[model samples]
Each structure stands twice: as structure tokens, then as C-alpha cells.
Target: MPPETTGRAIFISYRRDDAEGEAGRLFDDLVRAFDEKSVFMDVAGIQPGSDFRKAIDQNVASCGVLLAIVGPHWASITDAQGNHRLENDNDFVRLEIASALTRNVPVIPVLVHEAKMPSADVLPENLKDFSYRNSVELTHARWNSDVALLVEALRSYVHVAKEHETEPIHATVPVQLPPPQPPQPDESASAKSRTPLFAGIAVAVLLAVGAGVFAATHHSQQPAQTAPSPVPAPAPVTPPAPESAALTPFIGRWQNTAQLTPKDSLLRLVVSNGGSQMLVHAYGKCEAGPCDWGTQPAIVDGSKAVTSAYQLRNNPQEVQLERSATLTLEPSADGLGVTITNSYQDAGTHPPGKALTYTFARATGS
Candidate 1:
């Protein structure tokens, strides 16, 4: 690492299969609290290169603090071979933790999703020490307090390190010398005597100059010559024309209860125009089940709007499916009604499955 990148940094180690969402949220919060460059999340910071292990080790060593994010399934998660990942010596998470421990770096175990600290018996030999370190819990209910504690700890460490770095190895005490002695009495007396003589000469010269200046001013004075031309008032400034109204046909909150699953699910849509383009944020209400809600940027062409494709993860099957939505708007007596059509495609499939449509009525307030 270069000297510029040597200062305090936080390294977040997490498993995608475990608590990627929590880890990502924490990273974003840390970035805001500290700085974007100071918080390094593995996947976002990693660069393409050979010797991936070397990269991980270097980052771990250089960081001021390492945050090991432990989700519910972190330890027991299995690899493709179906063996426990923590049991494998070559596992990336294991390597990262082990390296940080070996280098005596401060390691903080962050427990998310109400996860408990792993017992010593469950950890591999190299990672057994991790069980003893103090752990912090991050719950959705107390996210602010938990993250504040973590930030305070990291900031304290960085401050101490900086103070230590700036302290002088060997300080020198500045020497003091006595003030100079007073000048001789004869020299002082002569200087004082000459000061008054110079002052008298200056006073006489000023009086003569003042008399001449008074005479010149008295002769040159002229009375109010022809009432000074009346100053014209400034022209009244015209205010700039009001900006053309924004294209905001679909810019408000809309909600609807699906007939197929009435009372169980509610669909909500929020739309706003972004000058050159449009933005749509959709959320599927889940009163009785899991729901996925996300924002997608869309392009607007007249009444038609299409969003970019984004992936939706199916946790149970461990599969990622691509989905995109198109919305068409039509003016109605009550308000503008939107027709949302969503298209889904599985991996390796060309054509998408049958599209689904949902209707939404504009809400009262923006």
C-alpha cells in the first residue's frame, strides 16, 4: 500500500450467502460516517489479479480495524463440495480472519440477524481465538446505536494511532537567554534632548503649510453651480419568466390491494420525473409473507415507461432471476391509472415467462 492509503481504514469481511445485505448496509453507513475511501468492502475494493489470497492478506494487514460480519449461517455454510466452509483451511473467510489474528490486528466480530458468537469448539484451530474477542450485536431495531458504537471505537483507535505517529521520538527543550542590559545614561540623555527640538521644528512647518492651504481654499470656493443635474432613477428590473412546469404526470404515491391476494398483499408505486428521464420506485406489501421491494431507473417516451433489467434472488433455490417492468399511463376521472407489466426470465432462457399486470390508483397527497 502507498503512504497515501496507509491511514486508518475499516475492512469488512462477509459472506455473500450469509449477510450480504446487512454487510452492504453497514458499509454504506460507515462510508458516510468515516469516508468512502476509508471503508473497504471486499468485492467492491478487489481488483482483478492473480494471487487473490495475496490481495486479501495485504488489505487485512494494512487496515486499522477488521470487521468480521457473522451472520446466522456464517460458520456452517458449505462449499460446492458440501463440506463446512469454516472447516476448510483454504476458505477465504478463514484465511482473512487468520491473517488478521496472526498480524495482531484489532478484530471486531459483528453479529447480525440476532446471530450468536460462534463457540470455540465450533471454530477451527486457527480461528478459535475469534470466539474469545468481545462481540457487538447489530439488530434492525437498534441499528443506529450499534453502528454508532462501532464508529466510535474505530475513530478512537485511529485518533490514538495518529497522535502516536505525530509525537516526537526525542524532544528538545528550548533554551532561554537573559534580556540585554540598558544603554549608557549619557547616550539616553542626549537622545531625549534632541527629540523635543525636532518636534518644535515639525510644529512650525505644519502651521506655515496650514495658513497657505486656508488661503487657497477661501479663494477657490464656488456656490452651487446650476443645481446639479437630477440623477435618473434606475429602470425597474423585470423578473425572469417562470420556469416551464416540470413534466409531472406520474409523480405521486399510488397504492392498490391485489384481488388475487386481498388483505395479504398491497402494491405501492412512487413515480417522479427526473428531467431527462423518469424514476419509479415500487414495493410489494407483505403482510403475511416475504416481499422484495426495489427502485429502478426508467426511461420515459410519451405515455410509455420502461425500466432497466435487474436481478431478483430466490433465496431457497439459490438462483438469480432477471426482471424488468413496463408501465403505461392513462388519464381517468379520478386520477391517472397505471398499468404495470413485469417480465421475468430465468438464467439461460431467451424468452421471458408470461407477463403479470397490476393496476394502481393515484393517492391523495404527494
Candidate 2:
């Protein structure tokens, strides 16, 4: 069997406030270079109400490559701790890039403005290598040429990565049948008769009885013979078989109300931007119910824009059933109201699934 193809979209990591316009253009170019579905552009791609951090992490993890859109202010931003931090080194970006790298996803550094390329001394220990790597410089005078080169490089990288992703599977050859031996002529007359000696005597006796009965009536009688039975052939052999999503930008601490019921309880879901994958942690309870911890898988599915699906973890039958729900996150047109559709499914014999949709305004101060 051939290796499975790793064809995927690219994740764009950049500081939105610092380079939305340029980043948006760069994203557009990338989409033109490859299947737009496989690329992630933060400027216009993220939806409102959905968990932006979670969405970004999931996108990066699932993508085939990570493109760092470094602008002049990329290294000037401060984390919550007020320390100047490179976007690539930011918690969310780090997680996304690290997850991709963990899976051998290619990473490309594209310089969007006049940001001084960090040297080994100034660069974070983890990003020192990227500092020395060649980058595409997009200045006003050479914007077109720089973009063309970046797109070309991205196209080539994706093409090669896709090739390596697919490996072929080989089928086993069938064994041939041995040649048949020639049939020998029967030496004994008894053997040539094709009937056992006892069976021949029995047939003779029956024929004699029939002759006695039919001769008396002047009817002719003859000995009876048996014909051979045919055997069926074998059948042919067969071979073996082998075997998200984007969400809108909802930046906030949202509660998982889908998990609540008349049984009495509430669950709090914190969808924050962790390094590579979304840091999804759940804590809360129905009236007096116990709380359990777990993680769920996410996917991207949408037409007008990319959508993300985050499946919640749920387990019942035990003393404490884990609360869970699926959130469909998508970005809004104005890039302010992200849509988050949360759904819930029941457990045991009778299960009732419920879905709740809402548009969340981006949290102030995010």
C-alpha cells in the first residue's frame, strides 16, 4: 500500500492589529497558489462568536504547512505579562507551529514589512533557526515581485509535501497452479467398468429381476449404468482494503450550556488559544452533579467561509456522565460578530440531541 497523502492547507501566523491589510493580500495570493481550502488567513478568514484561539490552534495543527507572516510590529507586541514577544513565540502561535512541526509540517517565514530580521542573540532560542533563513521582503517598491516569489515558493513547497504525503501500497502476486499429470489407461477390465465390483453385481441383480417381470410381458430388458457427478471449481482471491475545520472568531470565556438539562447543572468551557492545538478545558456542573475532564476533536466545514467543528467529550452510564457539546464556529462579514453554534447529544437508550446557535461580539480588550 502507498503512504497516505498529507495534502493540507497552510496556517498563517501573524499579529492581526499590525498587518491585517498586507496579511490579507498575502493570504489571497496563497489561496490563488493552492486550494484555498487548505490555506488559513487570519485577517479575513476567522469568524465572529466562535473561539478564535481554539480555531487558530486547530487550523495550525491540521494544516500541511505553517506560514509566519512577520511584519514590522510582529516583534513589538507584548503578551499579557507585558513582555515584548514575537508572534511566532506567542502561546497560541507557538502551539500551532509546534504541533505542525511535531507532525513534520513544513514551516516558512515570510517577512511582510521592514521588521529587522532577528539575529541569534535577539531571537528566541526556539526561533533562532528561522532568523537565519531567507525571507521574502515586501516593500512598497517591490511588492509585486516579492509576492510573486513568495507564492512561487509556497506552490513548490506544497507540491513537494503533497508528493511525500502519499505512499503506494503493493499487492501480493497469486500463486500459479501446478501442471496436471497425464491420465493412465486402466489395466484391469473391472477398473475400466467405472463402477465398484459390488455395485455392478447389485445392478445386475436388479436388471435380472426387471427382465423376469418384463420378459413375461414380451418387453426387452438391458443392464443399467451410472453416470459421473461433476465437482465445482474454486472462486478467485481478493486484495485487502485500507482506510475542520474553520470556526468564526469568538474570543471569550463561553459557557457550554448545551450540556445543561432539567437534571440540574451547568458546565463552563474555556476555549483559549494554547500553543498548537486549542486549549479546551471544561469545569462546571449540573445542579449538584460531578464534573469530568476531557478533550474533543475539531474539523473545518463551510462554503461561504471556512468553518470549525469542536466535538465535546461526553460519557454517561458511570456515576458521573461527562457533559459535552459540538461547537460550529465561523467568522462574520464585518469580522466582529463570530458565530458559534453549540450542540448537545444525550446518552443511553433514549438520546435527544439539541443545537444552540449564537453570534458573540469579540470580547472587549482581547
Task: Single out the weakest 10-residue window by summed lDDT for candidate 2.
Answer: 311-320
Candidate 2 residue lDDT tens string, 1-366: 111212346777777766777777776666555655656664245555656556655566566667777777765677678876554443655555555555555565566667655555655656554543334457767665455544433442355335333211223477698999998776787466766767889999999999898868984466555676777777777753211122324334454434356443324443443222233333335332433232222333342222233332222222133233444545465333223333334457434345444443333343
Please give each candidate's TM-score: 0.42, 0.36
Q: Please give the range of 10 consecutive residues that has the lowest summed lDDT in model 1.
A: 162-171
Give per-residue lDDT, candidate 1, residue 74: 93
Candidate 1 residue runs with Cα over 4 Å from true position: 1-8, 159-366
**Candidate 1 CA-lDDT value:** 0.65
**In candidate 1, how many Å is residue 179 off?**
68
The per-residue C-alpha lDDT of model 2 at residue 210 equals 93
User: For all candidates, what are the clash counts?
Assistant: 0, 41
